[model samples]
Target: MAGVRISRAAGALLGAAGMVVPLAVVTAAPAQAASCTTSTGPYQTRVERFLGRPVDGKQSAADCKATQKFQAQHGITPTIGYAGELTWRTMNTMLAQRAAGKTPNAAGKCPTNKGRIACVDLTRQLSWIQDGKKLTYGPVPVRTGRDGAETRTGLKKVYWRDIDHVSSLYNVSMPYSQFFDGGQAFHSVTKSMWNPPGSAGCVNMRVADAKAYWSLLRNGDDVFVYGRKPGT
Candidate 1:
């Protein structure tokens, strides 16, 4: 019979049961091939557990501190609360790289060799646009959300274009929408600039940035948004 697969948080319950019942510990899955220099920590451990790794005999306080430090050093502040969407997105990328068997250099940082993708650094609250070898867009500061209106973090393909911007539901036409989600979009906001932790979930940009961003794409452009930061 196969042993029950248990999550790290569930292991305690299973361990207690082992005292009264015959419970053979399940072996850990092989560590995914990773060349990252930073050691693992509580948050990473949680991520690993989420990825189906065992926490049985692996706990690293130093690694946790190091990981937290690494994040701070890289521009993400240490938030003691639950892992935010941005952190989770970064973690997912790190996990993917590790699973790919890539090795890190002596400095312990993940290679900056990830070609052309949007990576938002939450601490700096900036969006970096890359295309293969060049960083194309910005560290341009913009608003995100604070009232529980989180920016979506995932891959979304551009479907259509709404040049006259407004809540089409409201019959107000103003700017543009590449139309990633129903109403959520990237558009120009003449009202607010340099204000972060704002926006009702739409990525608001200045007219110039908005226009530039709009011009950079067409129908079917793949856009990956991560971190709840504003963008152009």
Candidate 2:
């Protein structure tokens, strides 16, 4: 499948444009391709079940394509249009959690003091900008740091804004970055990054949502991050 193309120098320049601080390179591995087959297996069965199909454990071209669609929608990586072991496991976890429930925590942890703030509930994997109780935007899907590198919680402020920020550490594009905590920003990442493998420490958003955030938020706006990621 096709991936974003950019030279090292170009990436560095993008990082520099964002005034990124130098840091150790993140050693996370890129997404890998998995083998596909038409044979039946537990993994295939789970995928079919999640898709509301007969639990026959059989793979088909149509099934593979449907899996790819699911992967893309959820930001799964190596979306090879097939239901591999990793794909099945990720889907199973998400299904087990039933994470799409609309309600956030009843605690209302978001700060009302600030005129407009970004509220990120890691537990729901959702975020929104609000003016006190009034909703301005969101509750959009987000991907936070995985097990090894959990995104820091608590209150923060939008100290920086970078429309074309690149990770100096990972040499990866981090578009529409709004830096709150040090080295941990809210930015747009590839949809594939949301699947089996996850972010290093940043809160990942879709490109359109990130752009919307950029437009809604201003420098020094309050940002509240609370709750735990589901299925961690």
Best by lDDT: 2
Question: Could you tell me how far off, in angstroms, the CA of residue 66 lies in candidate 1 after the best superposition?
Answer: 38
lDDT per residue, candidate 2, 1-232, as tens digits? 0013434653454355343232222334645545444555457777888887766777777777677777766556566656666677666555533553443433568877788999887766678888877777866777777766767799888867778766544566677878777667788865543454556667888888999999999978999998876546
Model 1, 111-227: lDDT tens digits are: 235544443333234444555545566545444433455556666555556566444233434365544443345666664333333555555666777677677766665556554
* RMSD of every prediction: 20.6, 7.5
Q: Candidates' lDDT values, in order?
A: 0.44, 0.67
Indicate which candidate wins on TM-score. Answer: 2
TM-score of each candidate structure, all chains considered together: 0.44, 0.66
* RMSD, candidate 2, Å: 7.5
